[model samples]
Target: MTRTVFFISDSTGITAETLGSSLLSQFEQQKFEHVIVPYVDSIEKAQAAVEKIDRVAKESGEQPIIFDTLVNADIRAVIATSSGFIIDVLAHFLGQLETALGQKPSSTVGRVKNADRDARYKNRIDAVNFALDNDDGARINRYDQAQVILIGVSRSGKTPTCLYLALQTGVFVANYPLTEEDLEERRLPRPLAEYRDRLYGLTIEPERLSAIRSERRPNSPYASLRRCEDEVRDAEALFSRFGIPYIDTTHASVEEIATRILVETGLRGQRSQ
Candidate 1:
């Protein structure tokens, strides 16, 4: 049986969902249907949410679970009347923090308004734009501005990894696709020579590479197993010859690849807010 789980917040509901999901993951045998109700800043909206929860509880014959991040007392009071198990995320910790710090907390809704937060948000946006602008070796001249440069054969998870690094961690990530000619040459591209210290390589198993390529260009020489094997072999050789660190991306997700790069390069401190 599946239970209903509601993530309620006065803003995007991201905080409620993130924390709630982590907590729910502990129950491995149960299934949950999630409902995110965001921007519940008003009493009317909170009442509506409570009514919805109550209706779900009656139909499912089980008390629904609610993860609430509401900071306003009036709005929170309205939601408290719902026929569900309420977990007030902020209220549980805010008082403890206030006592520890010897100060009253600012019970604000949504993101905290501050100049530093605004700057960090802007940096994230700028990083995303930089990743897009420099994707797939489009802007080699801009390598000096990049925090990290990813190099790999086509569809070796370079583009997605670069974008993930930029969006999630605000790292200026750029990717360069190593073509057949570059592989045959057995050397780093001229543009990447000056930035060798920032270069990270990604390789994939030939079978997986061929499979991915065949989907893009079926029945073509470029998608052949022989071609895939040759490219990956030479790419790995090139990385070794140049003493460049690399990772096999055959089974790694974009998030894993980006995280590995950050950890390997000791750039975890560069992660964004």
Candidate 2:
């Protein structure tokens, strides 16, 4: 079934969207259409959001689900009048938090983005730069600085996973693309051989890899299914020979892949407030 979801907030709506996605993922039986309504900080903007949501509700014959991080009582009240299942995400836990902490929340609007002002933000930025610098074996000399090195065949999801780990956890990541020569040798590359402890492999199903690569180089040998199969098979064999742990990325989200790697490696992330 298809349902509409609205993520409304006074600022970027990132928190609302992230929380809504996490919650909605639990309901695997239904498919969702997501709409983000950001910068809804005023009564006027809130009414506009309500209008848009009501239109979807009317056309679909179902009330849209709203996940809101709106803090202004006046604006929130405007949203409450809308034809939707409103979930005040902050109010759900703020009262208990206030009582436990023996203080009231400042009810600050757009405070989530304040993460950019702290040391954690700089850490994430540095890590992202490192990922870009060392991507696809471009700067093998920097491998010694990386906490994790992802090795995989082209288009096997090495690049995005590395960036996700860096952006989310500040983990310095480097990636190497296993080329035909490296795969044929059935061993790690000379530069990578010394970093076996930090090595992690990623593999994807041949059919999917072929389709992905085909988008970039259609009808070329690089995108052929046979080539993909050969690359994946040989890559796995190399990982096995080196006793390097790996994961299949074909069906996993970046978050799932990155979380698993962090858990397995016991790498440190996110400094405490």
Candidate 3:
């Protein structure tokens, strides 16, 4: 069944927007049709959206679910007629908050009063949002979608790189591991081969690689210095031979590595220019 969802909110409209985007991203998986109507800021816009939903429902003979977050009960009532599911998310939560605190929250921006502090918080939130929305596997077709890809062997810093890119640059990043099997064959996985044009690899000195691996898998052949050196050599050789660019992840911060990769790969300048 094709499902339609209408989103309504105020005050935290930005929050609502992100949630709507995430939900809409799943439409392909869920096989549901959806629409996001933000800033039900006025009775008129909400009414119009409601009317549209009504018209579509009658014509299609299917009731569409409406996800409403109207803080004001009056606005909620105006849209309630056509919405199959009217949810007042903010009110419900805030009501509980009021009950706990024994008073309503002041609408003042007191919690984020300092300009610099507010900006920092905003930036951090944006980075987290970018990470959740821009994971690595999703970056495959979307070179434009990635802030950067953290390419490395297991425990070679892919996850940290991805998290740093997200938290610092607000760029969506995804990481993929280069397995022993892939190194054995001296080729990227078949799936990654399709996106080789956008591929970036990460490497480290074999000794350092072995040290890090040992921490994760002590006394195992997988983390042996010899095995680590072989894999590192094989991976780097394969990357260089194929002309696929890579970075040495040793002794670099996430910011430094990500910036260098973007610059060297011409991914960042190309996008901006």
Candidate 4:
């Protein structure tokens, strides 16, 4: 059966959505329709949200699951009065945390503070800019500034993984594509050879690589299965020959790949600096 899930918050609703979706992932057999309602800090918005929830519950003949990060007690109370199975995501955890720490939280609304003034946010933006500047092996002179440099065959999940790491963790990341000439030569480029300690490799299965390339350039030699297989084989061999650590991205998400790279390379978030 399909269930409705609502992620509510006083701000962007990202926290509620992320936590709710992760929790829902445990029920592999269940299907869900997700709705995100953000900026529900006022009583009027809260009542409107409740009305929506009640309507869904009545129409579906079942209570929708609600995960709310709303910190205002009055808003929380209003939301709890709805027909859904309401989870006060922030209150439950923060309450216990208060007891453990012997301190009361600010109890203020999320995003009430200016994130633009945060150094972490600024650092994340800088890292994102760095990724864009150094993408696809551009501007080799900037290698020294990169925390981690990803080298991989085209369509092997290099560029996106770099950007994910940079944006999510404030890790300065760059990606270099292993082109046809480099794969054939089976040698590291002069520029990349200097940064061997920071180099990470990614390789994907031939069939998957071919399919990804086909989307970008259909019915071309570059997207051919044979070309993909050859490039993957050669890239892996180069990685092995040079002792550069690498992971297979064929079945991995960009988040997983970025995490592995950070863990393996001992990279820290630039935001923390």
TM-score of each: 0.83, 0.89, 0.48, 0.92
Error of 3 at 156 (Å): 1.7
Candidate 1, residues 1-273, lDDT tens digits: the string is 999999999988878987899899899999999999999989899999999999999999999999999998889999999999999988869989999999988777665658877877788889999999999999999999998899989989998888888877888889999998888777888999999999999999999999999999999998999999999999999999998899999998776788789999878523443
Give the per-residue lDDT of model 4 (tens digit) for 41-65. 8999999999999999999998899
User: What would the per-residue lDDT of candidate 3 be over residues 143-219, giving only the tens digit for each residue?
Assistant: 45554555567767777766765565445566667778878887777657655666678888888988887888888
> In terms of TM-score, how similar is model 2 to the real structure?
0.89
lDDT of 3: 0.67
Poorest lDDT segment (10 consecutive residues) of candidate 3? 264-273
| Cα lDDT of model 2 by residue, 1-273, tens digit | 599999999987877988889999999999999999999977899999989999999999998999999988889999999999999888979989988999988877666556555888889889999999999999999999999999999999999999998888899999999999999987789999899999999999999999999999999999999999999999999989988899999999998999889988889876222
Better of 1 and 2 by TM-score: 2
Clashes of 4: 0
Q: lDDT values of the candidates?
A: 0.90, 0.91, 0.67, 0.89
**In candidate 2, which residue ranges exceed 4 Å CA deviation?**
112-116, 271-273
| lDDT at position 28, candidate 1 | 99
Report the lDDT of model 2 for residue 181.
98
Q: Pick the candidate with the highest TM-score.
A: 4
